[model samples]
Target: MKNLVELDKNHFIHPTSSIQQQQEYGPKIIVEKGDGIFLTDKEGNVFIDAMSSLWNVNVGHGRKELAEVAKQQMEKLAFSSAFSTFSHEPAILLAEKIASIAPEGLNAIFFTSGGSESNDTAIKIARHYWRIQGDTQKKKIVALKRGYHGVAAASTSATGIPEFWSMAGRLMEHVVHAETHYMKGTQIAIQSLREIIEQEGPENIAAFIVEPVQGAGGVIVPSEDYLIEARKVCNEYDILMIVDEVITGFGRTGKMFGIEHFNLQPDMITFAKGITSGYIQLGGVIISDHIHEVLKEKSKGTLFHGYTYSGHPVATAVGLKNLEIIEREGLVENARVMGNRLLKGFQKLQEEIDIVGDVRGLGLLGAIEFVQDRSNHQRFAPELQVAVKVIEALHQRGIICRPVTYEGVDIICFAPPLIINQYQVDTILERLQDAILDVRKQLG
Candidate 1:
């Protein structure tokens, strides 16, 4: 309470926040506790966490059982090496559980500290697999524009937004970006993705990495046919389909993995965030049977790709149990139901709010865009900082929601925990509506 803000200003370099602004205002609100869908601030003001702590925390905060799981692991062989002949019980069990819950044939799990590292690892493994199989020419990786993979060199190259890749030019060579489903021409948006395959020349393309629903790129959920067509193209050219499930996995998009919603089976799926629900850092790459075999047999020698904490016992233990609880408590099904409720609630707001442009989401993940004129589909100017304004207004109203910022478009994004019920859903929508009104008044 006493200049904690000053201390934060002195230290803490916040991600995606203005350094000058933080020095001026310091930390906005410090949350003291979270239970289920409600988060209580230091001042005891409670509100819904609409963004689910940067779109992770699938199980929500303050799960005593999860704490116990972490504690138990700490008590029983907390640290162990998954590298070269050493393994831990929790890590092994967690791997088994992941194999069971993941898509058919995603039996191998290579761990990482977070999504960025997981994706980086995936690219290395993919290239390694190809080179050993005498396909060194297949190093060309294709990703969708406006896609958000990670900020690391390799994964950042897979990231579609140029804003993330500006200072660092061409993080990964031969990484070509294709037209995203959201930014595509109408026919391409609605039609299949065959044109992309034709243009990129599938022979030179090694992998096509995509998110089931583009997360940081504004929750852009492509049509089912688009993903289906992509899978066909990958198969035709023998290209690996890498589904970056960093945001869409673990029931946020209503399914275990976003790829599960479609018929396409990815050769590799990189997962993070929800695996440990933002408690402990945890992530992994789920590889299909074919890739696994190729990786094992055809590898020139040692694959030589891993982190010190690749399969940290504590993280894996929590991740395994997290999946277990999501299944046992039927949180995924709840996300589907409550997500519909949240969507309808937003649509009702869109009816009254002339500025609202589009509203789309699944399960616990959703968002609504704001435009200058809905009728003409005119967007507000990028200089206006509309999304940032809405986020600040929401903070004032006590709820926490993230805004997806494009070149000029403002989309209010929400991906609360899957554990939220209908009542909590209503509360989140109500607070968001209030915030939207405040932002509109400010703009006027």
Candidate 2:
């Protein structure tokens, strides 16, 4: 274990992690195995995977069915590129399955390796769709503030988070952000989108992208009508609406896809993470029938954009088996039931804990914002690091979660595996309450 930690520190540059913290603490926990909703470390310490390991793993961990499917696929046909009309059964079947489950009119699938690539592909396709229509002026992409797409070049540019841009110094051009669900109201948020389109000249805007429920941005669930209005606005301007379902897709939000919760149909839906329950890397963009028709009718020789692992047989096979498990076990319904319990737990925490404020969630995705004074909803000082401390406390108590500290927000996020039971939900809440109390006492 020590050697592994040393090697990780020396050779591994972890993604979206603090290098200084890694150097100071080596590694926080060397996770050895995962089963259901629990992860076991090399030191034999067990933890509740409350964040579902980056909001994926909808079907839970240690899925032997997924493993067997992967093994069988690799033995039979390890990989066959989908490039140049060369396709495999796994990709074809997986795409068909996804289209059947996806929202209406979204029938075409463009495979990518993961979330970032999925978003990039969606963005490019949106532009290509407009270009093929001879609307070359439609090039700009508008995303919502606090919306997290992914980290690829175009995806990074489209991401509304500032830190992601600051880290890489801006990767792509022609990307802008509009107001998200602000405290004022969803109307104002909708107005912000309209205003951006008007100002940018709707002709210059190719796509308007957003997440149904903001995940990394603190699980901010917009008002019911927010997405409906946004879709209407996109239709008004003839702009492609792209829904980034990388985190919210595949039962993470109780529904099959997060957009289903709002009854909103998008031009394109970029998805990853839960499709395979994190058993293997796989993601794709599902295009609406309208967009598909446009691409099919106008696309000339060679689409000119694709990944080497676009239709990897092993990943797609694992995804098919994973989806089968989700359907057979009814994990989507389980997510809805467990999500209610989780929200109720958060409400309980809000009533009991003075610092707990603005608890929100959809399906299994949830968050609890911290405030110094509940009466006025005054946030704790940034130096206090209240969210971080509370999460650290939870970590000590065998509960794993995530902390979102972007844009002056002190929020602790949770998205446990869909396979999590009532007992596990209560356990997470109980430990979270204890952790918050412990941190409160420390602060006092």
Candidate number of the best lDDT: 2
Alpha-carbon TM-score of each model against the true structure: 0.95, 0.99
Q: Report model 1's TM-score to 2 decimal places.
A: 0.95
**For residues 139-254, could you state the per-residue lDDT of candidate 2 as single tens digits?**
99999888888888998888888999888776888898999895547988998999999999999999999998888888999999999999999999989899999999999889
lDDT tens readout by residue for model 1, 316-342: 888878887889999889889999999
lDDT of each: 0.83, 0.91
- Please list the Cα RMSD from the true structure of every candidate, rounded to 1 decimal place: 1.9, 0.9
Model 1 whole-model lDDT (C-alpha atoms) = 0.83
Q: Relative to the unseen true structure, what is the C-alpha lDDT of residue 237 in candidate 1, on a scale of 0 to 100?
A: 76
Q: Tell me the deviation in Å of residue 215 in model 2.
A: 0.5
